[model samples]
Target: MIIELDMSSDTPIYVQLRNQIVKGIGKGEIQPGEKLPTVRQLAADAGVNTMTVNKTYQILKNEGYIRTDRRLGAFVSENINMNAEFRDKLESELELLSAEASITGMNREDFLKLCDEVYSKMKSSPIQIST
Candidate 1:
């Protein structure tokens, strides 16, 4: 999987790396037991300090999304939570999204209506997994 960093973003590089990794995992591109590139390698690719990659890896480890082995390196972890913590985190993310939407002049009702429409369409669409 490839990830690109935007130096222009206000968010810190480590946070951006962590967020992108999470997104890759969520999109099913990165699977459990998948080995991540070395921290130095990722940092070089991202054009950031090795410390940034280490920091991001630490966050992912704390979140139970990945674990590092001395010789094997970092790998995607199993046994994740599908509970209140996730719901709360998702809500926090939605709040930021809503704020951005509001800034772009999307009213609450319009946002809700749009959400319903999207949900309806999503419900109608079936996911097809490739073998």
Candidate 2:
């Protein structure tokens, strides 16, 4: 949907673009089967090169977040596959985050509350456009 890329950030442009698209899907802003903007269009709108957009789309496609066809271009995938590898990686990251939170004196309840708040925000973000 609506994407705002921070050019000054240390994160690569392609990664930021990919992450925003994933967030859009998770928030239901970009529904299943919805077509995304063409790479040239998105690149122009975001003030980035087409190659960057292509890289972002490729990553999304590989991760099962989107699909592409020669004639139809790219659309949101009907199903997202969160396989065992993804689950394991998520668990490991969560463990590290939880450890950091604990070290910073974040109690179990507070940490959970924070998670809920962030999740709620992500789900509620407005879906402005299909791009």
Candidate 3:
């Protein structure tokens, strides 16, 4: 997967890198246990500093999205846990986004449809919605 960074955007380079990697994993572009490029290699490829790449990897590791081994380097985590911390984080983010959508004149149905569309695109299996 190609890592694209917007230099002019307000988002930090490391955050952008982290988000892209997370999205790649969600989209199944990067498989579980798949090896990722080394920090030096990714830094060179992304035209960022090694420290920035290192920071991104550290964040991913803390989030349980990736794991690192001294001998084999970093790879995607075989199992991702959707524990309380992640759920809380997800809830907080969605609450903010939902408020933004409401303020921007999006109705409940439209907002939910948009959410479903994006979610469906990311998951390989069919989505089951419960009322």
Model 3: per-residue Cα lDDT over 9-35, one tens digit each: 999999999999999998989988999
Residue-pair clashes per candidate: 0, 0, 0
Model 1, 3-84: lDDT tens digits are 8888999999899999899877766678778999999999888889999999999999987789999898999885455556
Candidate 1, lDDT over the whole model? 0.82
**Ranking under TM-score, best-scoring first?**
3, 2, 1
What does candidate 1 score on TM? 0.74
C-alpha TM-score for every candidate:
0.74, 0.87, 0.93
Reference-based lDDT, each prediction: 0.82, 0.88, 0.92
Stretches of candidate 2 off by over 4 Å are 121-131
RMSD of each: 6.1, 5.7, 3.6
Candidate 1: misplaced stretches above 4 Å? 99-103, 107-131
Model 1 superposed RMSD (Cα):
6.1
TM-score of 3: 0.93
- Rate residue 9 of model 1 by lDDT: 92
lDDT of 2 at 13: 98
